[model samples]
Target: MEPDAARDIAVTDRAFFHILQLAGFTGGTENLMKLGEMNWPDIRDLDKERLVAVYPIASFEQHGLHLPLLTDTIQLDAMVESMDGKIGDRIVCLPTQWLGYSFHHMRFGGSLTARSQTHIRMLVETVDGLIGAGFDKVLVINGHGGNSADLRVALQELKETHAETRVYGASWWGVAAPALDAIREAGPNGSGHAGETETSMMLTLRPDLVQTDRLHPDGGWPPSVYAGRVEHFRRIDEHSSRGNFGDPTVATADKGQRMLDATVNSLVEIVDDILGERL
Candidate 1:
């Protein structure tokens, strides 16, 4: 390659990495972008045995007054960071998807969104591409609640022809719910949106971005207990006015650390399951 062209490529790579860091990919950069910080040739030399690709899907949306719009992306990236510590060398962490379906948050400034179909299409195609690239296992680690249903749909519809190739989707929060109950200070309704739970995690992961002065209660319009059993959809404006639905006043960095550890522990078990399938 020519010197100028090579320099241009190098500059582009650095710029992209910087963008990822600003967008909440710094903590997870190492694991989420190939392995060992090696270039293409290093990857080419790796063994071709069973491969697992883990990708993060997050939303760049409103998170009340206290949290940044990229809270979901930041949290998801942190999950990749946690997972990398536990299983980095064994799996390939694909880059994270920074945009998600956050139409409800569009009313709030700083929220970015995509059509549900677009989100689904992007997820399915990404997994399909990974499988086509010879990865035997594909795991999508989701960060945005709004993307949950669509991610489930995409995971269900993946074109799987080989028993060896497995595709799975999981929201880190959901996966850690059982463990959260043991440590969470917020009640069910209090942790709904930009509530205490999420705030706590953000406090631990990116304290510099959190604004304590803006903290407030986000008790969203409570739904009937019966409605919880079924699929019911509502927008943010109709439910909560401040773009949050839970109490963030009680969030603490210590709680955030514990919750993060719980999430990582849950992922460890899940990764084992994804890679331990018998042929």
Candidate 2:
């Protein structure tokens, strides 16, 4: 409540950083100044109408035995980093929302899920908040498949409720399919969740996180046919005993780089178009 307390906090921060430097801690101070990061005070001065808010939504879920449980969230970090590098001047990149609806993967250990209704409400409020701040476009770049159905609903509801602001949602793989398809080491049947494609990407982005000893082939749990034309949901343990679908032994760092580059390029094109809209 007083100037002395504020000064004390600032002094403590400086002392802590000085101690870290002396101990050879490697975190870059420049990262503390990153413009779009929510922790930075500079965000308060940002003019929403002049830039777009790109939110990356991911999940904390199991990614087989080899990949980390946070694959979706980590991959999104890489994706957002790529985009932020090229267009920092025109975007208000929000921190990622890592919790997602992953009820299907719940049986597998380490996976966390939000109730479907709560997930929908979270997305709606996030976009609505951005619109209220005067941003012309609110874009959600989703990396988890489980969130797809609800995300579609959330985006649609946002449009109906706030017609004045343009809202868009996209699945990264869908947007960059042509490029990823050309370089992938597996076919559709061999590539899905924690498949070769994702493994390769992680190998390039964070190889240490990959447990090479666990490389194996798995296509996941299969759905059941209902009424001779429909299908019923199945649990991961039932479909994929190993908690993974698709072949992963074929992953390579090269494919990861190519995949990441293609997605970044695709996103750049999409974001440019969104920013150019006549809102």
Candidate 3:
């Protein structure tokens, strides 16, 4: 019957329709808006009022020999896609930002990073542009660790400047800690830059980009000594030749899928909370 009625029935008495409802088939197709697939008018219509817009922030950085430079972007995009049908109404995905503050990766080839200040300015401008276009609640889904501080600073400034807008930033990997832990249990330490988790994720998202033959020469500082340092840029090439930070030999597609699912679920919950408070 009606969507609300169907949902009610599903909640009170679970049935096959509950599965359909959970899958979002009950919600009209118009509700599913893919930002990349829509024009300005489409976006305006889809976002008639202020909406929660999710921006996938990633960097084109070195991820060792096995994974491509675009690994971060790929994983972030996949995470966004995984949440598509679930958060269709409450949220909308923006085109992925393929460049971020990756100064630490500058020591290696194929790494394109913007100056921290420039990256912050770009993010501020992007949020401003989104607000100008009608999105008031912006959720930044960052994939790189280096961009976190800049993003926080930029978002704080935005909040101070525009009281009506709210911006939230979270790293996909960081938010999916539970899943990452599960993956780690399947192997060992999963915190490397291009280590098991990241490699597994890339393998799941873009298997074609993975050069399994070149998976050797695990890049970066030894995990035991990698303290979270503000001046991480100085230890770049000194720590690793290829720019990777962790082990990737244990990466598996199954673990990647689990991590992706966990990340998307966590993001959806966070977005829902933000939207609920705002709405």
lDDT of all predictions, in order shown?
0.74, 0.74, 0.69
lDDT of 3: 0.69
For model 3, residues 96-165, the per-residue Cα lDDT tens digits are 7777878877767888877776676667666665666677788888988888899889888888878887
Predicted structure with the largest TM-score when compared to the true one: 1
Pairs with backbone N, CA or C atoms under 3 Å apart (clashes), candidate 1:
218-245, 218-246
Candidate that beats the other on lDDT, 1 or 3, i.e. the better one:
1
For candidate 1, give the lDDT: 0.74
Compose the digit string of candidate 2's lDDT tens values, residues 1-279. 122332232223223322222212111112222323343234546676667778778888999999998898888878877787888777666666788879999988889887777677667765655565456687789999899989999988887988878888889999999999999867865668888889999999999999999988885433544423666655677778787889889999999899999998988888888878842
- Per-residue lDDT, model 2, residue 185, is 62
**Lowest-sum lDDT 10-residue window in model 3:** 20-29
Give the least accurate 10-residue stretch of model 2, judged by summed lDDT.
Answer: 20-29
Q: What is the TM-score of each candidate against the true structure?
A: 0.84, 0.82, 0.79
lDDT of 3 at 94: 64
* Model 2 alpha-carbon drift over 4 Å, by segment: 1-44, 220-231
Off by over 4 Å in 3: 1-32, 36-40, 47-50, 186-189, 217-233
Write the number of the candidate with greater TM-score, choosing between 1 and 3: 1
